[model samples]
Target: MGKKGILLVNLGTPDSPEVSDVRRYLDEFLMDERVIDINAFQRTLLVKGIIVPFRSPKTSKLYKEIWDENGSPLLYFSKIQAAMVQEKLGDEYQVELAMRYQNPSIASGLDRLKAGLVESIQVIPLFPQYASASTGSVIQKVMELVGKWQTVPPISFINSFHDNELMIDTFAENAQKYQPESYDQILFSFHGLPERQLKKCDHTGQHCLKKDDCCSTLTDVNKFCYSAQCHDTARLIAKKLNIPAEKYSVCFQSRLGKEPWVQPYTSDVLKALAEKGKKRLLVFCPAFVADCLETLYEVSVEYHEEFRALGGEEVQLVASLNDDPKFIDALVAMVKN
Candidate 1:
């Protein structure tokens, strides 16, 4: 009877777009067993010796391109989202924002809720699709911290909202509003994860389908399968918009390292579309509900240029859900449920 709290979680960003800041952030992010999922020694070497040292400078440069007056897009938008959700939820539920990594950590968010003497807490991870690296890590971290608490409050974790009716409606409505003209091709590009990491959760093969029936069919496993859920979201959104199946393609982007991640890579698909004579393309990045480096820089700018260079024209990148009223309404419905 004290208070009810809501913790809004998102994948974090570096404190600054400098190499040093990026390295530090990567050290914490990649060190997560859920993120890299390797043994300690191997994880340390891979993250520090290889990834942090090399990828940091490059990623920092990319961050610089997207850095705003406020700060990194992820942090800025997350703060806004937290404030908005708090305002919407009103005094009944104390809302706090936490980044899975970096400042305003999940532990701190939980601590704030505890300080408020909250009776129940809803932990909503701001990911449209579930990934062991993203949603799983948030869940693991929250459970780890809450486990050490003397009196744990009732908690509910909203894993993914891929097929939420409101979510689909929001995305469909946005697409309609932005690109009213019929698009020759619709591309749904999601953030990529290594295939090995995905197979790790393929227990019973019922949910996974291991490249066969897994994602193609909807089952309990598809609920947790990042690839499957992303595609399903695209399909559902397309259905809502009455888009033809053949006119759309689902692909993955922002792959790091040499390891094979999800396939039909976005770049390759773009080239293929250009060669296949699909001139006008409309792209969507549903993986990220908000516009970040991946959506803004990688897809909108980079891929837009790529398509043009390859003889395509009018490559329009649809905006992310980012605090859209419908999206906000969806979040409210999700939490209330």
Candidate 2:
């Protein structure tokens, strides 16, 4: 076999934090049938007419707040990750990075691998959990692009590493940097998905959102369930941190539209904690590997203010595993294996 190839893909960032750039990014991202889970006409109407026009400017401002001097924290760290993985793997394997939506697109990354005429390619979507909107989208996009290739190589996907020991350890390690015990509560917040999306994946038809504890444990039926995987990720990280189940709570953030999303919502959790006089909270967003607008601005800044107004002392966000050496090691092992 010829040299193997590794492609590390993450959810994209806007070319710039400008409203125009953000609008374009939103159009591409929110318009995806996998993302909005609606017909093109409806999705386009909702995204273009309602979401992009109103949300872009506001979101662009938030993006600017978190935008590092180098660039987007997500893209910057991803570049570092790809470079480090390449160095670790040495000349035996070629490593490339792509953002699923924007700059350094999957098409460009795949083209590079095709130029090398690699024997096989391992495409690792950076999402820890397998959401159709995230990991599934990346896989679908890669297949669509690679399908047209005259000499398509063998390809494999690392779909989900939510419970990978090293990954869990890295998140635990990041949390340990701060005083985990100093906070009143440790909130494990994952990105929210619509309830309908979760049910769509329920092959058992009665598993998702049916029982309260259905997502508490990972079963073969809910193995690919995003909510279940998020809970599992939280459980593993909390276990590593020696956090008692009662002391910490699992919640979801970034709910869109009026339709119910996977609950308990992070905002609701914060409000409840504040009402109960649980101040000085710590939050962990395990769904995201790198600090982006959601983590840096939304959780760190926006949520902080929300909790403060509700009579909480502080809502400290744990830094994500952005270009961390341990995280790169975990990625290296995942790819090389």
Candidate 3:
């Protein structure tokens, strides 16, 4: 056996908080057919004319707020993860990090791996749960690129690791510092996907959004459903934390556009918790493996203020698995497995 290459992928971020960079990153990301899931002309119009133009400046400002001295947390941590995984794997495996969008792209990562002439490649999209806009997109892009190679080495894509014990344990461990029992309620908030996307993944056609508890239980039919997987991930973490079913809520956040997204929305849940006199809340975003704009700015900063306005005392966001040693070990286990 020869050297095996490992490409760790995460959702991309802008090269900088600058408006132009953000607009460009958004353009590449939203333009993906799997992401927007619309016709070419309509997608182009929406991304360029309306979405990017309107969202870039505002998003750029938010990025500026979350930007660290090292830069985008997602990218920064991803690079560290790649280096760490490489070190753990030793010289037998060459590891590289790439973002599904923007700089340090899949193309560059693949190029480096190809130069090594590795015997095989394992592509790990950092999303814990499978989503068409995320892990699916990464897989699609990788296949499209590697297909053009004359002799593509044996390639494998780890689609979803939502059920990984170490991954779940990592999140649970992060919440331990907050003293889980102290919070009024614990909220497992995964990044939201469109309802249509969830339903589309239901091959049985009978499952997904058809019943109230459709997502609460994972089934063969709903195994690939993003919402179902998210709920299951939450259940595992909650179980580890010894959080009773009634004391925890599984919700989705970062919804975009006017069309219905996966419910119940985290924003709505937060308000409802406040109305119900649940003063303190602890939020866990298991969907994301690393802290990015969604976890940092949207959840910690934005949701904190929103919860405060709703009479909620505190909205504490559990830290993400960003370059944590245990998380790196989890990644190593996944790769070795």
Candidate 4:
């Protein structure tokens, strides 16, 4: 009988929250063509000369705020999710965990699968939504590595599972657990990508929505469009909770560089709400299945403080969908398909 296996991959974290470790992680992360999407020489200068040198110290400080005794929340939570999925899937399909960058690299994970003599491999990139930078990068990396092998197992990829029922249910469950006293506003913040990237989807500007009705409407392309899907997630969750559409907003966060990224920027939205005298806020980051730098430090701490500074009375960040049993069931179902 042919061996079947599953490999889970996530955007990784630093080995430690220290400045040095964070710098190393950033170097690997930002250097990626998908992440930076620039020429090699230019990417190097930006990553090493600029980002690693400057951003690392600041990011290291931020990581310290969220880092636990175990380590980076992203890495720790990912491990938990992987183990839970493994347990649920049983022993028949060996499961291995990997990160796109840093330790437990994709190369290493594939090596383990090869050593196990698995006949078929299933790759699950942990990003719930598809983006050229996230899910696309993983597929690119897998193909590059497997292409080098003289003999390779048949591979299948679970691309975007954003609207999976179990996933949506898990998110709803977490939001319910928080039980906000009565939020005047709910914000769904997703990581930002450059507008140039979004335009790349349809350069003619005919197929692209540019954050208009086309994106808001249910369509085949919008089904996989990260920005549209984020809005859809907010709508679904709001429908489940019976929240009014006027009470919620969908925004983007973690924007890098000066390039225009998909917006209603999260920071700008926070400031606007505060200015409008909307004090109570509940923010949810459904883009990230696990709490990472973006959700943990960037949204929970940084954005929370921003809201308060803008005279907001309260800002609560809903937790991520990490190792929640329903979410694990979603993963199993996703792979089973």
Badly placed stretches (over 4 Å) of model 2 are: none
Model 3 is weakest, by summed lDDT over 10 consecutive residues, at: 202-211
Higher-ranked by TM-score: 2 or 4: 2
- Clashing residue pairs in candidate 1 are 209-214
lDDT of 3 by residue, 1-337 (tens): 6799999999999999999999999999999999888799999999999999999999999999999899998888888888888888899999999999988999999999999989999999999999999999999999999999999899999989999999888999999999999999999999988898888898878877788999888878888889889989999999999999999999999888999999999999998999999999999999998899999999999999999999988999999999888899999999999
Q: Provide the lDDT at 294 for model 4.
A: 89
- In the predicted model 4, the residue pairs found to clash are none
lDDT of 1: 0.86
Worst 10 residues of 1 by lDDT: 205-214
TM-score for each of the candidates: 0.95, 0.98, 0.99, 0.96
lDDT tens digits by residue: candidate 4, 1-337 = 6567889999988888899998999998888898888899999888899888999999899888888887888888889988998889887777899999998899999998999898899999998778888999999999999999999879999878777777877777788876743788889888898876666655456666444666675476556667776777778877777778888898999889897898889999999999999998888898888988888778777888889999998778888998688899898888788
Pairs clashing within candidate 2:
none
The whole-model lDDT of each prediction reads 0.86, 0.92, 0.92, 0.85
Model 2 compared with the native: what TM-score? 0.98
- lDDT by residue (26-142, candidate 1, tens digit) is 899999998888799999888889888889989999999999898888788878878887788788889999989988899999999999999999999999999999999999999
lDDT of 3: 0.92
Report residue 282 deviation for candidate 1 (angstroms).
1.1
In model 3, which residue pairs have backbone atoms overlapping below 3 Å? none
The RMSD (Cα, Å) of candidate 2 is 0.9
